[model samples]
Target chain A: MVKISDEEIRKMVIARLEITPSKRKIIIGGAGAFTKKELIEKIKQHDPIGQKIIEVHLNYLRSFKKQQFWG
Target chain B: MIITRPNHDFATKYLFRWSQTVITLAKKRNILVIDLKGKRASRVELTKSVRKNTADFIFINGHGNDDLVTGYNNQILVQFNDNEKLFRGRIVYARSCRSAAKLGKSCVKKGTRAYLGYTDDFIFYSDAASKFLGPSNLIAKTLLIGETAGQADQKAKDAYARTIQRFENSSVSEKDRELIPYLQWNMEKQVCLGNKNARLKI
Candidate 1:
């Protein structure tokens, strides 16, 4: 396994989230919904929601790595 | 059937509206529904309703964490080691974030027949809330239609898989395709605790 710094992972997650449309809003539990721009700012701020988004992205990547998709 | 719909913030508002479909289905199935909507979704009301309707299947829609599920304005409704015992002998499907991690387990330990919920934060997109909710609602809808808790859990996951598959298609718009990750997250996090064979009595 390749060792990546936490900063690198955060950057990767933020970059991936950047491609999402600006109008799109994702609801993350009680923190409510956030647009891509807001999420990016949160990521930069390293708030709980930002960390959550990072975790979510990492989890999705792991699923992709395991080929968990039906296809 | 007792369902709580807390329409306070954006997240709860979406859940509140989307969960109406399950209520409608319950009524159509001739199941009596005790709806705790808005301020009525408080812990007091939920406790009273549960005590009164001991066998009512509970469908909770709100924000939550590993040890507790909330209602309107984030009021704590059920919590681990607090009032989870109230769910004993009843089936509960909590469409809230992370409650299954601790609260659901506590409920099961306290004798809840079956508890279905997410082990992680339950997420969805605002533009496609209804589509996401369609699968989420299946837990309660399937139960109301006489499926066991385990079967309802599988049916909901299958619905999520079908939705994700549809979005994975090349013909689908990129905007819609963006929803697949969140869909997969919810599907993977959803869990059925206690007796998988437990069926609703009401």
Candidate 2:
């Protein structure tokens, strides 16, 4: 299998997030609710929250690879 | 038992509402509860309540960072060095973000019996509030029933695992499957510090 880069995984994460309903909101700590569009913008900027989102998605993918479903 | 519910914003509103389950569970057990809701969830009020009541369990629901946990209007309630000492000899379960990393440690170092919290952001969606709160609420439920702090933490993590498994099932919807990453993040971030054997006086 060809190795996938972080940027590729990041784009895939963004694409996955695109399917999220606009009305649905993701609340992160005290920052309150963030719309999908706003989260996409954050991902593009690669800010702290964006990096966190990327990490969350990547970790979820890695879990399947490692067969570590629960910790 | 003392619980702080700060209903100031969208995030806190959900916390405030979900924390009622904990309060109800405690009340059902006939435990003496000193609930500080809304404006009463302030620094001065929390100090006074802790000093006077000496409640064995402190359940705080609010937004927080590594160094401090806030209450109503994001008012600083208990900070790392400022008021963490107030929790000495007590078990605290802060349903806030990142407090376990710093403040929880300080509380333990200051003589707190146990501290259960998340080391990073506690993320959840509005529609799936119960899914997140269920595991969190389990900590208090198990503790109130004579389980040790460590046992309670493990039970909560087990609950999180079960919930995550359900969402990962092949028959589950895509929308629900999307919540898996956040749930796993929360499960990974949850941490238990201090004496795991610590139990509430009740």
Clashes of each: 0, 0
Here, model 1's chain A TM-score works out at 0.86
Tens-digit lDDT string for candidate 1 (B1-202) = 9999999888888888888888898889888889999999999999999888755598888999999999988999999889888888889999999999999999999989999999999988998887788888888889998989999999999999998889989999888887777888899999999999988875
Each model's DockQ score: 0.73, 0.68
Q: Judged by DockQ cut-offs, is candidate 2 incorrect, acceptable, medium or high? A: medium
- Residue pairs clashing, model 2: none
TM-score of model number 2? 0.95
lDDT of 2 at A38: 89
lDDT of 1 at B81: 85
Question: Per-residue alpha-carbon lDDT of model 2 for B25-128, expressed as tens digits?
Answer: 88999999898999999999999999999689999989999999999999999998787889999999999999999999999999999999999999998888
